[model samples]
Target: MGQKSLVSTWHYLVALAAFLLSYFAGLPMPWIIVGVIAVGLLRYAILSKTSKIDAIPGPLVIVLAYVGFMAGFNHFHQSYSMAAIGLITTAYFTFLPNFALIFVGAPLIERTQKNTCIQFILSLVTASVVGVIVNLACYLGIGILFPSGVSSWYAIEPMALVWVLFSLFLLFKYKIGMLKLILLSLAYGFLLFLWRLNKMPMG
Candidate 1:
């Protein structure tokens, strides 16, 4: 395989491994350490081989940095524990799929198309919609089942909104077809319902 393809494959593998680790470990020490190491390796390998750093959007970088800083600030005031470190480490896993989809998968989709730019935009929007649906389902199910315990729905809302709006913007910018527009609208409606049910704001 070519260098790019190799790098993409490695990224997918790393994402899958981190996801599995997070799923089984439930924000514990070993899993957190594994996730951090996996992310570090993925970033380093991509940078070294492709000379392409993950071009995270400026807004996302700022938000993540702020979150990290705040978390660190909290740690400074309070005693930092393994549990806190693990939670923060696990939270980083959330971005892997988003980054992999847009950077690794979307480029391949673009390359395979005659109208690469248009296809890339469409693929990205579709993936974002799917991601939103999956996350919504996850959070809603947890809320319903637990009813009173700690829930992830509120925590993930901002990131989900960002992806949804970004996807919508891409759709408008690319002038996606009416069929896709309708489908995306329905997906958004479902998302709204879930948000309301979970007592989370749409944006």
Candidate 2:
């Protein structure tokens, strides 16, 4: 296989492992599977040169989504640390090919070298901070405002917050169309509903 193929394979492996760890660490099976599939598809899209937007990497998405998921559900438990490790791993992968490309220039390769460890670490930290702050603010703010009531429906799931924040960021930063953003937000809600279908009556 070519170097790029190798790197993509490695990304898939690591992403899968981290997601499995997250499942063991308390993330539900359905969410873990969805997370892995989403990241895998994003990787495939990037490698295939079919992705129109490169500003949102799967690792960053995972971090942001997970933060929102935690906040919305308040599901912290004994496996928090393990789940956190999985999140960190996902974030670390965000630095591969350098985060500089996220803002400008060509798409980055799915690979990072030892010489750029400092840059990788810094990017990981930065993305983690951004993810936490953005997701927490949206989820917690909605939670506080609604508290309890039919209005609280908006604050009940991480899916809406996750996709909304990411979609809005992409819409503004990269200028993806507003229609796409609306579709994504709707999709996120549907995705959440499907995931909960098994646990809730009529989902």
Total clashing residue pairs per candidate?
A: 0, 0
Candidate 1 segments exceeding 4 Å error: 1-59, 78-125, 136-147, 150-203
Worst 10 residues of 1 by lDDT: 49-58
- Deviation (Å) of 104 in candidate 2: 53
Query: What TM-score does structure 2 among the candidates reach?
Result: 0.24
Q: Which residue pairs collide in model 2, if any?
A: none
lDDT of 2 by residue, 1-203 (tens): 45466346545654543443321322222233333333353333222111111113234456434533332222234355644654454456434323443434322323443448856785775665466446544433454334353354554545445665687689789998867766775676578668888677762
Which residues of candidate 2, in runs, are more than 4 Å off?
1-157, 201-203
lDDT to native, each model: 0.44, 0.44
Give candidate 1's root-mean-square deviation (CA, Å).
16.1
Candidate 1 structure lDDT:
0.44
- How does residue 200 of candidate 2 score in lDDT? 79
Q: Write the per-residue lDDT of candidate 1 for residues 1-203, one digit (tens) a residue.
A: 45455335434543553543322222222222232223343333222211111111123323233333333334335434632542364346446654555565666655667886777786775666466445544544343334454555554455346645666687889977757765675687678778778996557
